[model samples]
Target: MDNSSSSNITSSPTELDLDNLRAIKVLGKGAMGTVFLAHHASTDPSALSPFALKVVDKSLSFAADADRRARWEISVLSRFRLHDPLHPFLPSLLGSSETADILCWAVPYCPGGDLNVLRHRQNDSVFSPAVIRFYLAEIILALEHLHGLGIVYRDLKPENILIQQSGHVTLTDFDLSRSLTPKKTVDPLPVCSDPETDFVPSRTFTRFVCPRKKKSVTNQKGLRKAKSARVSPVSRRNPGSFYERSNSFVGTEEYVSPEVVRGDGHEFSVDWWALGVLCYEMLYGKTPFRGKNRKDTFKRILMMQPEFMGKPNALTDLIGKLLEKDPTRRLGYRRGASEIKEHEFFRGLRWDLLTEVVRPPFLPSKDETELTEEVKKGGIDIREYFDKLKAPSSPLWSPSLDEQRHNVSLTEF
Candidate 1:
């Protein structure tokens, strides 16, 4: 964030004393690394700019490509700093620091947490259509900017989308993102679902007619809402997990794109497919192509199509176009997000005014101005904490975030 500066200290990657930083609390802990809310030890902890510090233990045996992935993410964050007026929906690198035992970087802390946690707080674990549109619009712009820079965000799950204090969002965790040179543009292919008017060549899944199980509704005549899905953008892995065998695949299972699943090459279009899945999930409270397990899930993603309940609508139509199994014909494949922005569903949207919107659908109630008890008490010393961790006899007691909000599957390494 431009407002908060960790630049002076982190810009220079050198060993520091115990007096430089204070760890507020463990924001999250995973196999790859741990995230901490930290403020400068030099200032009044309560009235200073705090940042989320993602520390990757260089010594972890299971974190394959730990240094590379961490550096890639930092490099990507570094790239963000170069943009004149940074994209409102993307994160900025506060700064970065690395020592012999750990690699850590800083970014603005998102008080509202991730999208999945927000969705779970909703009445039925789903967003209203209006709220869905607002969030999806922001996410689209974020992806649009990333894709514009030739960086493909392979992982577009709710877990990576964070709501800012201003109620806008910033896409986080770029470790899975890859830079791809887009294919040369051709005359955009026109895909028609009707068999009589179909012009798509080498069709794999033109129209999936498989029946879907519908929920009992109070008003039986009501149509259901749209939901979302993705492919590619593989995540890193730890050793000896149940899904260690499928290291060949990438991206989260439920959101992965069809081309990625089939070993076909993918580019920017994969993110668009994931956007569709996100929309579907926000509207319907579930992903469109989920099955019993990883194998069955990939099968459904390949052979089946998402089904809609009640009547077809503009949102559903957009989702359908995005979910096209053929990557060549999927919406935004050739034209990028401009193609998606032009869909009937987003006909009148003002892209330029997105950041200006004051009241977003969701906002973080946690006041950053007021320091929490952990922060007030001058919490753990980061240097000492790492020093202890570097010891062979360091205690093992790190907990994962709430299981309900996190979808843990190492199927894609």
Candidate 2:
């Protein structure tokens, strides 16, 4: 129960000692690793300060990729700590621990769970325009900060957006992100006097704009092969140079941009495209272009348009512009987030006063926090718990069943 905060804003990240942690319950699991609700073992268990610990088991068969992604996520989180004035919506690396068999890191816990869970709690499983606007704005600012640091966040979905104690949102899961240099433009040349005529040419000469190379749909099918042979997902290319494209075929199927699906290479605008899909899902309770299978989904993303349920409005209009098939034509492509901030959908928003809003659309109750506390007191060792579960003889635990039982007696927030 050493309650000392491991988060230091002034220095590089240091590995945390695992002996001080106590696991409460499992939060979630993914291809990368498992997350646990944990707190300082020496601190009072009932104290309201807890953090989420993500642990990657190095003993697993797929440990190499998992370990690489874990380290990448840690690097991304470390960047936020180095900022002079930290961005409010990005997670800070609270601590990290590395052992021969495991790699663990901690971030402040978001008791309200992820946005997907929150949306399911609503009456119709959809958020209203007001709520969507509030959440979208915060996400935009977070992406803006990441883009400024030459990072492209490839994954953008409801499950990655977590709600903090104050009801503000913080984005999570940065392992899929890639660092890219912003596209650079050459300066126009000045006109000079002609050698014989001694006359200056007209100043209105137009510079020829080079068109971006297009990849055929047939060739795009081999994008994965092309990428694997050329560069790794976690590439160490010169990020400070003018190159701005990533050929890595990464990102969730439903939220992947048209450019990504076509293997045309992607830059920062891909996040804006995913933002549109997110906004649509928040309002409609489902993604617009999802299909029966991965191939079908990619086809729909490239060839189909988002169908509107009713008459179009400012919000829908914004979504339409952001989802433009051509990345160059996307709403935020040229000017970045400033173009999105000026959209009519966000008109009259007091961006500066967003954090000061006393009440948000929803807030987690005291009972939920208490439920988390009760689970932690069950006396299960965090590392040993996962190891035991993985044994052939151990009974498989169903988190869904536990969630169902917990929900039975709970009141709606």
Candidate 3:
């Protein structure tokens, strides 16, 4: 983490040799970053070729500290390189490096921007149930791989899943991802080891609880006890480093899992809970338990009440089981994915067959035939907009660690 070189990484693609890849355009922009659509520098367009490249903006941070934060992001993404070759659903890693203002990592480019963008543009905002299940199955396999390696993808929103031109799905954005292993080391290093203490209860919980609790309970002495009993502060330190928590709000409120919202310790089951939320959204065009505000949203999530309107009975049942407020009663029931797969919703799902199922219900339109017409029509040119984003003169733009550690918004995304 001390290597300053990584923090001030150069964004110049000169080192990356993009000669192998051609920039098509930008995908989308967010507070912290932008995405681009790049093709393999060497490819025969007429024949099958290498996948597209995903270039993430490392310039989202504001200063040296933001640069340091970018380094942490780099560390998180680097972990994916360790994925087992045999893993069915893990995305292929192409290459990674630090840029002055962006941390460039190349991976198989997914042509589809994200499920959210796709659905939002659709009139119905819903996908076929079979198609949704197909993607879920892949995600389950990916989640299993992440959990096996101690990583947790805290942000599981539809925006993070990309549908490829070939109709396969790939997970992206490790900025919010983390390891489940405590940072503490059994064998101490010369420096103090980061204990597993940096556990993020999950952004899923931020909008649900006030972190601090107080009540007016009175004792038999007819005297009120201290209005606020002392409770351990949720550790905000990233057990590994003295840096403050990186995200103010943990998970998107609409899709937060119960255990995360309640601040009860959570394990990998939280991811499953998010998957359930995603499935529900995919089928219904909205969250099953949305509220007008954070308070109401938390109430619904904590109460475990979701109105499954018009969803298939199988999906409905699966969502119900996964959304259980009590983690103990969650679908895995501590047995893990085995129970999930065994559920009636997944009765016909063949884990092995599902991975190789190449025909997805949805895919990106690849015929460039309409490209010129749209350009002349003054329609959105997402690709060029993204490519034109100025390389930041400073480190990426990240909220102060304090902003991330505290002041989590209860309503905003």
Candidate 4:
């Protein structure tokens, strides 16, 4: 816990008093808690600005873990708020508070929505190379800053990459992230002088596209019915290590690294593996190593290589290097993000000037930035909202819905 960076944070009030805060709408609901579109109750309700408040209801069965994660996220955000000068791409803690039955923290709202939703809005449900490059560069810089602080962002996916009002990307969800102490180690692989000739292979690899299956009426109905009944996968407990390797099998199923799935110790390299999966998903429409279910997905992650659909290119080459099974041999393992920054795919990228870039791929509509008229009429107490939802007659706490709510996926929020 270093507080040296505390002096540098001046953009927003460092401490938010929950008594003055009001919830506008439910932004999302996840495993840890719910995120609400909130603002200071005294502030103009019609104002364009509002922040997101993540609240953990402590009366729930899993309140302890959720409380710990909420606090951890606050700590992580505090560090970024005090130390990181680049606020455009990282979340800053506007305020945080706790009560006997609740814990809550607020962050600047990202109106552009998460990358997953934005990608779905695209015509082909995928981004062009240029858009991917822009977004990836911002993400790389954010990861670089986190690594510099000795933190490992184990969760890196489209869902966590949020778009700012300026349309640039900002990463969210630090609950799954862990702080690690980096040990000095020698690079096992030598740096190549000629990146162009050293990395590119002569043979072009072709990937087969799996055909989409048509769903029968009964199958479609079953899927629709199952949507509300699906349960979240079991969460992995923290290994509670600081300087040494972490052995916890934590991460989303599709984006998890090979080492994580094998239950072998993991460090910062896991993020690079996830970056490869994200890049592949951005290029094509889905994850490369996905299988039928969780078991099959994990097995493929350990034994299968990422399948690419196009001919050999700098982007594909970068993906291949990042997806390397050996953590040490991975593209960013040794030098961290510096190695990936120098890759041929990002050869001409001006990493230093990333924040100055104007006109990002998409700008959020005005409706996203302002509270709806209907929402403006009501001022809901954050704690009372959850308490009411958990009451006996409430739909959220009903016997049948209790299991579903308890097992809700983390992505829903």
Query: What TM-score would each prediction reach against the true structure?
Result: 0.77, 0.78, 0.65, 0.78
Listed per model in order, the count of residue pairs whose N, CA or C atoms clash below 3 Å is: 16, 4, 32, 0
The numbered model that scores best in lDDT is 2
lDDT of 4 by residue, 27-132 (tens): 7777678888888866746545688988898999878777777777777887886673645778888877777887788888998888988998998999888788
Candidate 1 Cα lDDT to native: 0.69
Ranking by lDDT: 2, 4, 1, 3
What is the Å distance of residue 204 in model 1 from its true position?
A: 44
What would you estimate as the lDDT of candidate 4?
0.72
> lDDT of each model, Cα atoms only?
0.69, 0.73, 0.55, 0.72
- lDDT winner between 3 and 4, please give it: 4
Query: Candidate 4: where is the Cα deviation over 4 Å?
Result: 1-13, 185-243, 368-370, 392-413
lDDT of 3 by residue, 1-413 (tens): 23234322233222444434444444544433444445443453322343434444543334444445445455554555554453545555555554444455555667676777787776687877666777787787778667656666677878778776766677766555555554432221121112333322322211211232232234312311221221113222121121122223356677776666765555566677888889889888888778777778878888857786663587788988888776555665344565576555554344554544445566678866544343334432333333454545533333422122122233344
In model 4, what is the error at residue 281, expressed in angstroms?
0.6
172-267 in candidate 2: lDDT tens per residue?
988778787555641222221112322222211121111223325664356335434533333334321234688777777788888877777788
Q: What is the C-alpha local distance difference test score of candidate 3?
A: 0.55
